[model samples]
Target: MKKIFIVFVGLCLLIQSRAIADEGMWLPSLIHKLNIGEMQKMGLELSADEIYSINNSSLKDAIVALDRGSCTGELISSEGLILTNHHCGFDEIQTHSSVDHDYLQDGFWAKTKEEELPNPGKTVSFLVRVENVTDQIVADLTDEMPFAERNASIQRKSFEIQKEATEDTHYDARVQSLLEGNRYYLFVYETFRDVRLVGAPPKSIGKFGGDTDNWMWPRHTGDFSLFRVYCGPDGKPASYSEDNIPFQPRHHLPISLKGYDKDDFAMVMGYPGSTNRYKSSFGIDYTMNETNEARINARAKKLEIMKRYMGSSQKARIQYASKHARSSNYYKYSIGQNKGLSALQVIEKKKNIEQEFATWANASEERKAKYGKALELIESAYENTQDESAYEYLVETMVRGPEIFYFSYGAKGLYEALKQDNQERVKTNAEQLKTELDDFFKDYNANTDAKVAAALMEVFNNNVTPPYQPRFFNEIKYKYKGDFDAYVQKMFDKTLFAHRAELEEFLNNPKLKTLEKDRAFQSALDIFDLMSVLGSKMRETKADLLTGRRLFVAGMMEMYNDKKFYPDANSTMRLTYGTVGDYIPRDGVHYSYFTTLKGYIEKEIPGDDEFDVPGKLKELYEAKDYGQYADADGTLHTCFTTNNDITGGNSGSPVINGNGELIGVAFDGNWEAMSGDIAFEPELQKCINVDIRFVLWTIDKFAGATNLIDEMTIVK
Candidate 1:
């Protein structure tokens, strides 16, 4: 009876706190229908006026919006200090980490601004607000308009609205239309054209168990990184300026000096990538069944291949971390998602929905008009381009593309075309970039080239491309009588012009490089050249297939405006609202809203790379003096869970409350939702975030950067 009462009371508190979190802003249908001031019921204790005042005043100017060269971020300080998740900044930061100074392994910290790392081509964009123009947008699109024309019309309308909304505003902004032709939202933004790194934990600490712990339960990793935003001489936005000044945001979050307890009212505001809880069953099935299995299987194989080269070469390690990071990410996320699909019964649910939709529509003419032809439409699409489309991704991503694909959607052809397009747009940049290419090639990977080639050869032989009778293959055959390993080796490095040294050394080695110098590598380079052509074909087909399917769904979905879709999770700015609470992930298996400092200690296998705690964190826990925010567990926990909706692109979102106070920084979600690309399991899935309190604790206790903490109002 007593336990029941406690749970009942706890439920009430959770409801109240969730209400209090959104003190003023209107709640989207996703979070608990919360209004701005509703969070007080959840133990916020503060009145709506107080919360609104805080949102409108406190830190309003303190939190400067940050763009991680792409996504949005908030400046958490007055001195150009920035805060974002470790994953968001990993790419640029990784470029600077190496064997001698492996920051990813240990994490990066700058004692002062001068020591902060500089990353070229990175940016931070600040958002102002978003407005809806749905009715106006829909009225203009005629049924007669061609798909191309309709899209143009929508773009013009959206662009105009964006221009007007951001007119004369110092910040940058854009308008994105969601659900094809159904709705539109204009986002006003403040862009800091040049952003630089401030600090970051080592990869061990930032990424912790690397990909092993990503999006899992009972996770104990700190996936956070730090950076600073910069602008031009006149305190304006500019691109890559040495003469830039540290940008000071209008409002910065006052690091909560008074920590949080279990039911604190909170919310997160940042661009969330995407959530497909509302997708069709066919979409769900393809992902949960075929796509998931195929992708995970391929990734597992690719990892084995990558390990071979990465272990053998340091240069290979450096060049491929980005690719490794991407594949590892997919591998981890996919497996987790596969687990989620089963656990959440995503496949069954998809089948059920498909059946239900059909049964519901069989009797009604209106219903039939609405979606009765799903099977016919779907089958036609599959027949029209399945093989060609599959080949597109294969050609673009796996074959004729860099095995070490970076920023190439598994398609090197498309990447090159885009690269060319960008280069053409900047002729001067093309000239300057020519100078950078030599250095890029000098640092290019022999091992990576081999690995990618091997992967490509595997794809070509196994799939679309035929087994060719190239000399590279013959070299392997001659060397090892057709042993696959020997074959792989020859294909990887069997240069026709075997000139390891200069041309003079290989005198009659009429092998290609015999008479030529470094030109011996030309055979491989020549094939690399054809990448653009292959990429172009792949791009067109991929667009025709992926886009066609997506657009059809979007077109079908144009009628369902009750829910709003943000976009394809393009790593942009977004906001997710939820309260602080925990739930039972499975039967009788409860997950606390918060974990503790002691939890970290218990998990630490002292010196075990996966569980090693930083000295500062160890000291704090050893002291056992958690300030106001420590949970009943007696440990200061950095991570927490919530019921807020999210997906891959939401990796670094900031979780906030009704008053818009950031309670946590978003990173990953529970694996059960990995099918989230198509299904949503509200009961079992939760978003994992780095608590705001942890961010504060790191700044004050560990990093010893107290200057940032003192800048915020430490509310109790």
Candidate 2:
């Protein structure tokens, strides 16, 4: 049975591999020559060798590299140029842009090589390929090993593999687990340390419709950016150097000129964060739908308050910039998930999954016994944490949240992170504060005092000892005559407005040595110190909460379900593939992959600030310069749709053909896929890709990046 299971998984992997290999749609080639012939027969312009040749692994590098959260660029040029999304590179560009060079407001341009702007410390990564280590991992995680012990064993193995593979090479690799505890793979990646900002379109052109139009179809946003990766003299990763050369690639995608028609197969090759296809009806139905609403609402309130302050005060804007982005991300996902749940008819799906479980579990005495333990474990965790865990969770959240506004994983695995952990995360007390709060002031933002104070106070009151005392209580008392509110208010009214200089002043002040001595602050800092090593403690606590419940919910699903179930998300890489298709959201509403320029103009109202499309794009629309691009909207005659499995990290993934030519970048998934976290609806699930033609026209006519566009096979 196990052999059959392994073979089944392998066959599925082979099918997918062949779907991409040499661009054959369905048939498997018997030889390399046959494969090449089949690829060309299927309009697969690029060969398997060509595809593999361009898959260089030297993109992830920089002096201070951004974490996985940021959409990274891939070098398409040997002359040191890269391509990424506009939003991903916005901050660095904004930092260098000014009133005279207002890249943020009007966008930027560099007609010649000398015109490109150098970003002091930006990097890009290229993934070479992946290999399996399931045998080694499964052997190490034998039945006698506990989950923690199993995880540790895997980690040790991963380090060994990474060191071996990356030695004598300026590259990095890591081990990854798949199918919960079923499979494992190792990915090898090469990074380019020196990357520079090239050009961006103005907000008017780039972010035209802004947040309101986000996630909506038939959109007209020029969402693209240009960058270049540079390598040092010895042909290796290095810090920014004037003499650095543009990286040469083993393979580079030639841009496709004739855009895709409907029903064309497309695949996204990149990292995807998580998917909850294996979640129980219990969590997806009861917990996620109900609990996520409250969590989302709480964050919505925080965002509203922060936005109000940000709109009025520049100091507040800069200080809480990270906070707003973090909160907004939650807001976006929450709202999208809610929409997906509604679209999926979650309440109904919940009933269906439950009915199936009750029938299967009660089928026989043997069935009931089989599911009992798994069910019990999940119920226990829910009972313990449903109400009481939020406080501690919030404290833990506070310690990690702000630090990861722009960073993914909140910068886990830092040098001092593990040294500060408590032996056990059993009791929520001074130990948590000491380990988690140790780094609080080290990276604290002084501006946006109201929000920071409010967040801390909430965490303190809900999770800390005896509840209800501000951080740095003693310091505020000594510094401002015993009024925490007054001290916060003083910080808000006086200190925050002059944010940058004032923060330095507060940290450096001799009299306010109180910064380090503050009791509440110290407590929070201690917890920060221990956050890394406490993963096991937290995971154990978590296991106790959900999947551990064998007798309650998880058991029945595990024992009797038709498909094998994996646990809920733990930030792992997963691959979900399906057909290229569209979905009907309601009785009438539909979406498409290609949204025409004419359709965007049709939706526009004259004299409206937001509705205005640049005159040039409008002219191109009037002339119907689509080349071969088609309108996706059947009813509105505007846009098109596709089905490519994607999520957060897939935002900037390049959508490619069997020939390995760039089609369009995968940006957003449709509403159906939003339910993807809890339920992988193969029927309705689809991904939204911005067609390559829209990108081509924007570059050639709009941004006049004609030279860059000319590098590709623009068939026209």
lDDT of 1: 0.55
lDDT of each: 0.55, 0.52
* Segments in model 2 whose C-alpha atoms lie over 4 Å from true places: 1-69, 72-75, 78-80, 285-291, 309-326, 342-372, 386-487, 490-499, 502-512, 516-537, 543-580, 605-612, 615-640
- Give the alpha carbon lDDT tens digit for every residue of 583-673 in model 2: 6666787655466665678667654434666677677767766544343332112224556555666555566665556666666655445
- Against the hidden true structure, what lDDT does model 2 obtain? 0.52
The TM-score obtained by model 1 is: 0.76
Q: For residues 1-716, what per-residue lDDT tens digits would candidate 1 score against the true structure?
A: 56434322221111223222321112132222334334444444434333222235432233333443233355666666777788778777777876777676666777776777787667666544446677766678764565566667778887777777777767566666554334566656566667777777765567766666777766666777788887787777888766778876666665553445555656555555554543454555556555555566556666777666766755566555656777777777767777876766655554554454456556678757655665444434444333443444354334434432221121223224344555443344324434444334433555555555556445443433323223344454566664544454553344322222322232222232221222224334434444554455444434234333444445334433343333434334433445566777667787787765666667766665456777767777778656665644555777888766566655666666545556677777776566555554445557788877776676666767665566555666
